[model samples]
Target: MLLPFHRQQLLRITLVPLTLLLASVAIAQSAPSVIGTRAVLTTWSDPIEALGTLSADESVTLSATVTEIVADINFRDGEQVEEGQLLIRLEDGEEQAQLRASQALREERRNASNRASQLQERNLAARADVEDSQSRLRQADADIQAIEAQLANYQIKAPFSGRVGFRNISIGALVTPGMELVTLDKLDVMQLDFSVPEMYLGRLTPGLTLNTTTAAYFDEVFSGEIATLGTRIDPITRSVSVRAELDNADGRLRPGMLMEVTIQQRVRDTIVIPEAAIEPSGDRHFVMLIKQSDETTRLAQQEVEIGERRQGDVEIVEGLAAGDLVVFHGLQLARDGLAVRLIGIADDETDIRALLEADR
Candidate 1:
């Protein structure tokens, strides 16, 4: 009976403290509220971005001009070669012998022509005979030149300075004209080729500056200038092909590198607001507008069309106007025409990027 009396006293004390805690919570919840706003009057600007790829401005596959067996390869695969450097050699064989034979025939004809000239000077040869000997000498000279040119064709030289690709031909391998010997790419300067949609076609032009970045070189940005624009747009994609040239004097940029490119279009002044200020539902978009009150606040809903979005700021294309108070926070608890206290305008301009960094 004494223990029961002590427990009852403890319960009475706990009930009084708990009752006071619940009453305070209810009063505090009814006092004020936290809300966020975009304060729509902020200035806005929009920029367009695109993607592209890096490639060598000049690339080609080198091939031999005649049928022959490979005798030697002077350059190794993937080696940088200078203009006129010897790349490959083919067996000269019969061509060399032919050149020598033609040379001997030319000498014999020259000797015969010299004798004919001396006879003509002495009045012992007919004019037609001298003329025939002169003609034979000329014909022999032509044959020797032709044979020499054919012999020279056996040796292949690099046409331009560039990096050589993998070697496709081995010693003693028979190759015909037009067979790929190797690929030569001029990487000192590279070209970026990409397409832009027709919507931006009017803004595309030669000499436009662009900044390009690649996954391979994440730390660096490659700068390029527009070099060419396709005269015609593709009917299927409704896009135009654009070529930009970049200087790769350091040889960091390479061919076949996937890249993302950004080009800035025209600038326009408009009202900028936070993306959170707008409510998106199926095909409609709207924002909660805060109205002023002597001692309380009011809310109104307005439909809006959004424009270019960047860095968390979206352009207000229509509906919302400058100086319009846009609700950014406490939207879930807000309703159309709800009466609220101004308390004060919340600092809705929190850098969303900073919040992202904190999360990371």
Candidate 2:
């Protein structure tokens, strides 16, 4: 070991250089890392909000046309079915017997008609007898056709392709004419119906795009377009009926689901910045802008004339041009002429800490 005096001298020499190195690092990082934002020109619109209800594009309540005992149920609850697919078969024992008997009689009559016609062709049978046999055959055909039509009434089939509702009746249950059995809905596309006040009637038109959200899928935004508008406003509510259609090929949205709707209209182009960047000073609004000169960048306070404010953005009408950088986050460093380092763009998606670490 060296003497204490010599050690003190060496230690002082080493610590002095070490302190100098640390001081240099601190000077390099003197400028705070801040997430910067650039003025962006974007389309602006006036948003209209309304509550709506969703419905299947095609829906119907399945029921029977005639009173009969249920013979068979071909579908389960919530089953997908095709058009003309048989769903229920009522007891048709009597109709089946009638059909069989009519078919046999028609065959016999046809044979007799053929023999009579053959005899007439050779001039061996009377004209009246041949005509009588031919008429009998025609009558038999009509009788069979009538029985077949009656039998069709005993069967219930789907009118369109869709999912079937809950089973309302079981096998052997008695159903009457027009009795409610089940429901069928085509869910590939959904229809949303809402009411807008007559005050905005002049702006209502077909093909206007709208966004809708439901409580069931809060994070999901479904887009649709105006399909139609009611001809007359409701006298009581002073509101007009509006219908919009949305594609629900995934079947997440169901009939009778309540949704919140927003429609955008009267689009205009404007420059916008995050609302957090604005600083209020009595009647004036100011923003901290990043000014870059060669390799040095500093903050400058600018008074900007603002237009409409929507959501989290404020429209700048004056004192800011497109591509001008502004400090969106770290507003605590609001001192004018303060130096700041540009770490990253503070877009809506990026996290502030992540930006600082990436730049560091």
Candidate 3:
């Protein structure tokens, strides 16, 4: 059953070529083609966004100082009023009558004091009578002053220049002391209250500028500067409170309006790579570099440290350079030091073109 010597030699020789062919086919099928790209270097400004709210810097609710019926409402709802302008008048009829009576009594006391002085000069009146008349005159003057002050309180004046809110009291309504008449808010300037993490405390200062936009007015962007920093940090949130003042001269911004604030952080030059170029394995991150020859290409693995990420790009803090070629997609098919064949990209436009041509 054994083959002849020549036949056996021919079989062994053919076996070698067959084995080589199978090996080449297996290697080609096992490895895959991966599309890649180069990491480009660029500088970018870093910005952080936060949520905030708008509020009036100056606001107050005017109220009655004395208990009485509202006699007159001088200002309409939502009326712009100036400081010291009369806004409301309570029933001052009683106070007015009391003031008039005090004034008459003060006149009579003055006359009595004068008559007493003349009698004393003529030695027709004792010193005690003159002293009593002087005391009565002083008492009458004090009573008149007290009545005037009380009557002035019946007329409520605007505390500051602002727009009045809806009237809380109507004419002829019995009003008690400390009863609210209407609300007022100075809208020429507004305060935006927001918070930032304690880590940003150093970056935020009294004069730092920021940009803000509201949901109600999405297209409009308002500018503001830091006005005040909280002396104490919130223990629960570990965040510091900050406020910025915005000039709303046109009265476009309303109190209680929600707004979004953006703060630009300090910029630093660093190497950046597209997010697609980075491959993560456990705690390690890496990329693949491609080098080509005349007939084949090769891939090399690289490790890098990544920093802050914005949009679709990640910053490279270390382990990368400006000219590093990185695999963009199909990284799962890549292997260390594997030969490759680029299916596309002409030699004229490739970085590996010169290297490949030289090798040929």
Candidate 4:
């Protein structure tokens, strides 16, 4: 029974000393731990943004020229064709028969003309007979040419080298004149068209470089140069249209794809700081800028005018200079004028999460 009482007293006496020792240790570490970053100077540009659309380098819709029954389809859907390649053949049996007849008449007239020329040279035929034979031969040649020209109306050929679209007509289907057959597009280069306000006309011109982004290829940036400028501004909207050409060697960009365009403008050197350092109060913004006085480092509430927020960084318009340090993390425990211990400097290459876990 005496040993138990002694043990209790011993614990009570050691409790006070242990509490004091812990208090002293915690007080020594009471200075808030924070992660800081230095403000940097970098180039910034104000870019002009606008919406645009992409089109093929050359696009056309093939159509029928004469009302006739479809005889043959030479090309399939989505097939690449060469210039002057036959795409379709309409039924032309009557024209073909006429062509053959014209050829035979031409051959007979040519033989007669040759025979008349020989007889005239030997003085056995009159000059009038030779002239008549030559006239008939020329007339036959004209008839053949006229028939061949008419036969071309029944055939459809590709006007240029490109990829063909869907086949609209089948064999034996009667097609009328001016009826749409299929579409063709040359996709080696793409054309982009956008509009800009008239006020920006002075800054725009041919050969200016621009970049475009689309939802289909979100991470990819397509670049091009201005090809044309609008001759007149739209009186109603006060905007002018602009056209650009983009190289589509991979054939990824198709016709009618909507794009967002960006053009670079004025560039300036500005001070930038970590975005996480900003503290919002009501409608204003502030940062806990690290200050050094004598041997102690303290924090001060510095008001800043921010311009643009970029990837993990922001442009500081005022109240900060290059090489200035600011507390980026541990802001919840920060207080103005309080002494702080710099645990780490947040580096651009280092991940923020790894830094936080290490401090914990």
RMSD of each: 10.0, 9.9, 8.7, 8.4
Per-model TM-score on C-alpha atoms: 0.68, 0.70, 0.69, 0.73
Model 3 clashing residue pairs (backbone): none
Candidate 4 global TM-score: 0.73
Better of 2 and 4 by TM-score: 4
Number of backbone-clashing residue pairs for each candidate, in the order shown:
1, 0, 0, 0
lDDT of each: 0.80, 0.91, 0.82, 0.90
Q: What does the lDDT read for residue 37 in candidate 2? A: 92
| Local distance difference test, candidate 2 | 0.91
Model 1 lowest lDDT segment of ten = 31-40
lDDT of 2 by residue, 245-355 (tens): 999988889999999999998888889999989998898999999998885678899999998898899999898998999998777865789877777887768798877
Clashing pairs in 4: none
Give candidate 3 regions above 4 Å deviation: 1-49, 111-135, 267-273, 280-305, 317-360
Compute the lDDT of residue 303 as modeled in candidate 4.
94
Q: State the displacement of the C-alpha of residue 89, model 4, in Å, after optimal TM-score superposition.
A: 1.2
Highest-lDDT candidate: 2
User: How does model 3 score by TM-score?
Assistant: 0.69
